[model samples]
Target: MRYFIHLAYDGTAYSGWQVQPGVPTVQEALNTALSNVLRQSVRTQGSGRTDAGVHASHQVAHFEADFPPEMTLDLLRYRLNRALPPDVQVFRIHEVDERANARFSAEARTYEYFVRLRPDPFRRDQALYLDRGRPDVGAMNVAASYLVGQFDFTAFSKVKGAETHYICCLYEAGWHETAEGLVFRIRANRFVRGMVRLVVGTLLDVGRGKLTPLEFQQVLHRQQRIAASGAAPAKGLYLSRVEYPAGIVPAADVREPA
Candidate 1:
């Protein structure tokens, strides 16, 4: 049977979501935990890749397994958590259509980057601390506003990325203040490798008055990777949400932006 897992992980300890020959990874950890509980080898395909040190509050993966007699999903979740590393967790597991895929079936994905104004010991690993004068959130929002709608985001993507094309349809992108700090949230149909970090870096430049909002737009339209600023630190980024079609997941499982 095919099953979908709703999981989250602190990527601080992982090389990335995918497995590597010698490095530890979230996929390897999850596969091992599942195999141990099921008494057979099990593998999962995740919604997408997250670079090293990038966290995920909501991630989905699909795996095929022959659930043994008397096996319950709740029990399986409990056991998987026990077997998995402390930083990784399985929140929900449900049967999925045999054809449903965690990655290909996804309709949209949302990511958030957190910036803390002051140093906080507890969140040192999870946020970017800006020691300089506060950035102009108003200017940043103006720059971010340009991100909504379909565009070729080659400027924000990795130069050597494996994606065939750089076109993406963004539904929203904006920055707002939060209790923890300031956050930038962006939702898009899909994102190329390293896109969010690169975009965040450029937006921060705009916020700091290093680039005008129009210049930011021009950089994106220029389509030259060199025209953009460096990628922001991965520690501040999170794969906050993923949404799928109704046929792939129950209606309650899918989300709409506020």
Candidate 2:
């Protein structure tokens, strides 16, 4: 049977999601844990790749397994978590359609970048500390608005390999003040590698008065990576959510495994 695994991980300790020879990764850790519990080899395909040092509050992957009639989803979840490291967790397991894919079936994904204005020892690893001064939040928002519609994100993407297209439909883009600091949340149909970080960095430039909103829009139109600011640090970014069509996961299996 094919199952969807809902998980979260702190990417600080690993080399990102994909497995690499001689290097630790979230996928390798999960594969080992699942294989140990199932007593068979199990491999998972994740929703997307996250760069090193990025965190995920919610992520999904799919794997196939044959189970004896006695096995339960809750039991599987418990065993998987116990076998996995503390930084990675398995929270829910649902029996999905044979054709449902964790990546392609996803309708949208949301990411958030955290920024801390004041020194806080507790959130050092989770948020980016800006010491220059509080950025112009209003200007940042204006810059963010330019990214709300569908556009080719070639200027912001890191071109590692050939891609079919650079188009992405952004549904939401905005920054909001939080008690801890400020948070920038962006939701899109899909994101190319390094897109968010680069966008965030450029917006930060706008907030700092280094780039005007018009220049930011011009960068997008230019379709050149050099025109954008450097990528924001990965530690401040998190894959906050992923949404799928209603039919992808059955209604009865929607809730977290008990």
Candidate 1 residue-wise lDDT, 1-258, digit = tens: 999998989999899999989999999999999999999999999999999999999989999999999899999999999999999999889899999999999999999999999899999989999999789999999999988999999999997899999999999899999876799999999999999999999999998999999999999999999999999999999998999877777666654443
The TM-score between candidate 1 and the true structure equals 0.97
Error of 2 at 139 (Å): 0.5
Model 1 residue pairs with clashes: none
RMSD vs true structure, all candidates: 1.3, 2.4
> Using Cα atoms with residue i matched to residue i, what is each candidate's TM-score against the true structure?
0.97, 0.95
Separate clash counts for every candidate: 0, 0
Candidate 1's C-alpha runs over 4 A off are 251-258
Most lDDT-accurate candidate: 1
lDDT of each: 0.93, 0.90
Q: Which ten residues in a row have the lowest lDDT in candidate 2?
A: 249-258
lDDT of each residue in 1-258, candidate 2, tens digit only: 899998999999888998889999999999999898988999999999888999988889999999767779999999889999999998889888999999999999999999999989987878899999999999999889999999999999997735688999999999999998899999999999889999999999999999998899999989998899999999999988888898876666443310
Query: Residue 192 error for model 2, in Å?
Result: 0.5
lDDT of 1 at 18: 94
Please give the lDDT score at residue 195 for candidate 2: 95
Q: Give candidate 2 regions above 4 Å deviation.
A: 250-258
